[model samples]
Target: MKMVFRWYGEGNDTVTLQQIKQIPGVEGIVWALHDVPAGEEWPMDKILDYKSKADAHGFHLEVVESVNIHEDIKLGLPSRDKYIENYKKTIEKVAKVGAKVICYNFMPVFDWIRTDLFHRLEDGSTALFYEKAKVDDMDPMELVRKISDNPDFTMPGWEPERLKHLSSLFEAYKNVTEEDLWSNLQYFLEQVIPVAEANDIKLAIHPDDPPWPIFGLPRIMTSQENLRRLLKLVDSPSNGITLCSGSLGANPRNDIVGMVREFADRIPFAHIRNVRVYENGDFIETSHRAADGTVDICGIVQAYHESGFQGYARPDHGRHIWDEQCRAGYGLYDRALGIMYLWGIWDSLERNKQEVGA
Candidate 1:
């Protein structure tokens, strides 16, 4: 596995490229032009600028976390064709900068949802927390205010500009259903998969953050079966997935290890992290240690090793440890620590394999 780190950008992130370089085994950055609105083609000069920065630090710009999908595309509006055309152009631009995998999601309204950004854990370190009750009971607008009012850094999915139309977006999605979402996603893939393939880039869709519908919004990328259906949508090697453990692990039913074994060839990127699920249906991000969370992190890594995975992997989300005031889930310290833990598991598996062969 080729380990990578997520860096927001120069001034937008607290963690620097210098710090990421110091992390052992991290060879690239999973990045995007966060300032650019979804559906618009990314500026070629800005893309080159990002490439230069990473190249200066000896990091490959192989993976992009997202080229955010326009709500028009997801909503299947008539304007979607324009956005889809722009998306095709964006794919070509990122590929020019040496991006091998482009990670995007089709989740409508919100990309990811969480109740508390800094929910304190038993160990005093905080992490992103998801409370099911809050989602079911609280108004999404209130939750939007809580998430979007941040002065520190822009949250990936909860961009203020997007949430500014929360009510309208929700109303627009009221008539949309799960099947409708699947059809819309298929429409998107049909148009863009050929562009991605032509660019030698795998278009990997991130699973819904909680792997479930929220605020009555339809979420289709939530389970193993749904993912299988997604792969068959385009039926091309370029059509792929960004398998996220913490996102699917929230439900406790998703067999992440099984998914790795089944979709190994198609997955160009993996987000390896752990989350502890409770009886009450809430979950909190935890250390990558298997004991710390419900996810079978060890087995998941083992599955990748067994499959001879040559794709990019990253320590997805981590706790707010050492009082490091940073992005809610994208901190330097704990993510670095998570990387070491993942390496420990992978290295031991390699050593054991060598021993068995000997």
Candidate 2:
């Protein structure tokens, strides 16, 4: 596994590239032009600027966390074709900058949702938390306000521009269903996958944040069967999955190891993190240690090692550690710690294989 770190770029992020490069096994940064709105064509000069910065710091800019999908594409609006054309152009621009995998999602409106950004844990560290009952009872606008209350930092999915049209977005999805979402996603893949293949960039779709429908929004990328269906839609190596453990692990039944074994060849990127699920259906993001959470991170690593995974991987959704104030779920201290934990697992697997060979 080639470990990478997610850097939101200079000025936008508290963590610096210098700090990222100091992590023992991290060789690259999973990044994107966060300032650019979804569906707009990315300028070549801007892409190069990011590459130059990473190169200057001795880090590769080969994997992007996302190129946000336009809501028009997900909603299957009449204007989707134009946005898709722009998306294709952006894909070409990304390829030009040597990004091997472009991680994107097809979720409508909000990309990921959490009821609390800093729910205090038993250990005094804060983490991104989901309260099941509260989500069911809370008003949509109230939830949005709670998540975006931090004016100083920008949340990944809750873009201010998008949330500004909260009521309109909810109304627009009134008639859309799960099947509609699947068809729309297929339409997107059909248009974008060929271009991705031609550019030698794999399109890895990140699973829904909680792996479930939220606020009555249809979510399809939530389970193994759904992932299989998605892969078969394009039926190309370029069409792949990001294989996010924390997202899929929210549902205890998801066999992450089985997914690794089954989709090993098609997975080009991974977001490895842990979350402790409560009996009441709540969950809190935790450290990457296997024993600390419900996810079988150790078995997941073994599967990746046995399958000889050569793609990029990163530690996703870290806790707020050492009172380091930064983006919710994206503080540098815990994420750096998570990287070492993942590296420790990978090293043990490699050493065991060598011992067996000897």
Residue range 1-358, candidate 1, lDDT tens digits: 9999999999999899999999999999999999998889999999999999999999999999889999999999999999999999999999888999999999998988999999999999999999998889999889988987677797888877888988899999999999998899999999999999899999999999999888888899999999999999989999999999999999998999999999999999999999999999999999999999999999999999999999999999999999998989999999999999999999999999999999
C-alpha-based local distance difference test score of model 2: 0.91
For 164-273, candidate 2 gives per-residue lDDT tens digits of: 99899999999999999888989999999999999999999999989998888899999999999999998999999999999999999899999999999999999999
Query: Once superposed on the true structure, which residue ranges of model 2 sit more than 4 Å away at CA?
Result: none
Q: Tally clashes: model 1.
A: 0
Candidate 2 shows a clash count of 0
RMSD, every candidate, angstroms: 0.7, 0.8
lDDT over C-alpha atoms for residue 215 of model 1: 84
Look at candidate 1 and tell me the lDDT of residue 189. Answer: 92
